[model samples]
Target: MKKYLKNYIWVILFVIFSIGSYFIGFKPGLVIYSNFNEFFLEMISFIPFLFIIIGLFDVWVPKEALEKHIGKESGVKGIFLVILLAMLQAGPLYGAFPVAYILCKKGASVRNIFIYLGAFSSMKLPMLGIEIGYLGIKFTVLRTLIALPLFILVGYMMEKIVGSNFKVEEVKT
Candidate 1:
């Protein structure tokens, strides 16, 4: 019970907040309810499919295959591969979490996982296309050019700070 409460403290707080919002006024409560409903709908529509896909990937893709391309010793090729995978992926940032966990378990380096996550957060291909449509080709290209290198740099820096040999141990939840 203590562990469950510890893990879900924020959720409990959110429920309290929602109740307080209702007591304060119907409008505030409705707004919160509507937002949560929309988010829940989106998660149901998208996240389950992503989870299924990741599950299949975990089952079918050999760990050795992942390590060959994104392992600690894979060097520049690994970096490029991670970036490519990240850009191609479509969905919310939260969707990448499970994928990253799988990759870590499959022997992908900490640096590469960080790079993959950075690219997922910043350079998703569909979002990039939308950005180009609204922000123009030059702005989108410039941002991508700038952000990619920066993300790589951040990944390397994090790896150094955390320890060059660090790898994620399997986290049993």
Candidate 2:
């Protein structure tokens, strides 16, 4: 029942938004027509693969095993790992949530979750080539490098302030 309701939610949202959009009577024709394929393509391309990777990670990387790498003690090493992990990822925020969800479930620390999301949000190395092509290597690298420390800091602060409810609760010794 919960699962059915969850799936129904999106359909409901789509209907509401479509109806609202029509009544809003704005010039959405071009915006919707021009972008629908791109949006659909992105969803099809990213979401399934993201789910598979997350499922695989959950299966392969046991909670006890992950403690060595991403636990609280890992600190800066964990931050770097998160950055690399984020850099390797592609697609939208939804693409990354499955991994984040599993990480939280697997005893990954709250601070690390913040770092992981921050790192993932900040480091788009997969798109660096496009960024460089459109802008320049120096520009892309400089921006990312500058943002790196800030992202880590933000992650740290967020973990401290938001507390750990954002992730699965684990007993702290």
Candidate 3:
């Protein structure tokens, strides 16, 4: 019971706050609760599909292949591949973390993981189309040009900080 409470403290607090706010007629709290509910439902609907894909990737893709392609020595080709993967992904930024974890476990370089995350946040192809449609080609292109190099630099700096020997530990369910 104690362990369960510790693990779910935030969720418990959120429920309490939502209910308390409802009784007190707090408009902002109600709005926050509503938003949380919507987001939670969205995640619930999407996460299973994401996990299925991740599982398939884990089982089907050889670890040796991943290491060969994106490990510490992979360099520019790895960066480009990571960027392409990020761009092809369609979902919220939060969805990228699980994939990153899998990548890390499968032997992706820390730099490449960071690059994948950075590119996913800024350069998703679906979002690019929307941005171009609404914000014009020039703005979108300029943003992409600026973002790509910055993210790459950030990834490099993060790799230096984290060191090339980093490895992710597996979490037991």
Candidate 4:
């Protein structure tokens, strides 16, 4: 019971705050609660499907394939591949973490994992269309051109800081 309470303390606090606001007629608290509720619901709707896809990827793709494609010695090819994968993926940035974790577990380099995360956050293909529609082709192209190199640099720096011998530990369910 204590462990469960500790794990869910934030949720309990949120519920208490929401109820307290309702009783006190606090408009800002009520609005925050409403927004939180909507966001929570939205996440719940897609998280299950995301996990299912991640599970399939974990099972179907072999470690050797990942190592050959995106491991420490994969070089520029790995960077480009990870960027392409990041761009092709569609979802909120939070969704990328699970995929990145799986990639790490499967033998992907730290550099490639960071590159994947950076690109996924900024350069998703699905978001590009919307960005172009609002910001025009020139701006979008320029931003992407600038972002790509920065992402690579950041990845490189992170890899150096984290070291080549870094490894992800398996988590038991």
What are the candidates' C-alpha RMSDs?
7.6, 8.2, 7.7, 7.4
Q: Worst ten-residue run, lDDT, model 2?
A: 59-68
Residue-by-residue lDDT tens digits, candidate 2, 1-173: 99998989976776666667667775674466347657677567655655665556556644443334776667778767666666666667656667777677766678887777776665755455445655677998898889878887887788889886666544433
Predicted candidate 3 versus true structure: per-residue lDDT over 60-156, tens digit per residue: 6454443347766788998987887787677898788888888897778999999989999989876776666557799999999999999999999
User: In candidate 4, residue 4 scores what lDDT?
Assistant: 100
Write the residue-wise lDDT of candidate 4 on 24-132 in tens digits: 9999999999999887886676556655755565566454443448877788999888887787667899888778788887778998999999999999866775566
Deviation from native of the Cα of residue 163 in model 2, angstroms: 1.9
Across 22-93, the per-residue lDDT of candidate 1 in tens digits comes to: 888768776987799787786576556655655565566464444458877889999998887787677899
Best of the candidates, lDDT: 3
In model 1, pairs of residues that clash are none
Segments of candidate 2 deviating more than 4 angstroms:
1-68, 164-173
TM-score of each: 0.59, 0.56, 0.59, 0.59
- Collision pairs in model 3: none
Query: Which 10-residue window of candidate 3 scores lowest in summed lDDT?
Result: 59-68
TM-score for predicted model 2 compared with the true structure: 0.56
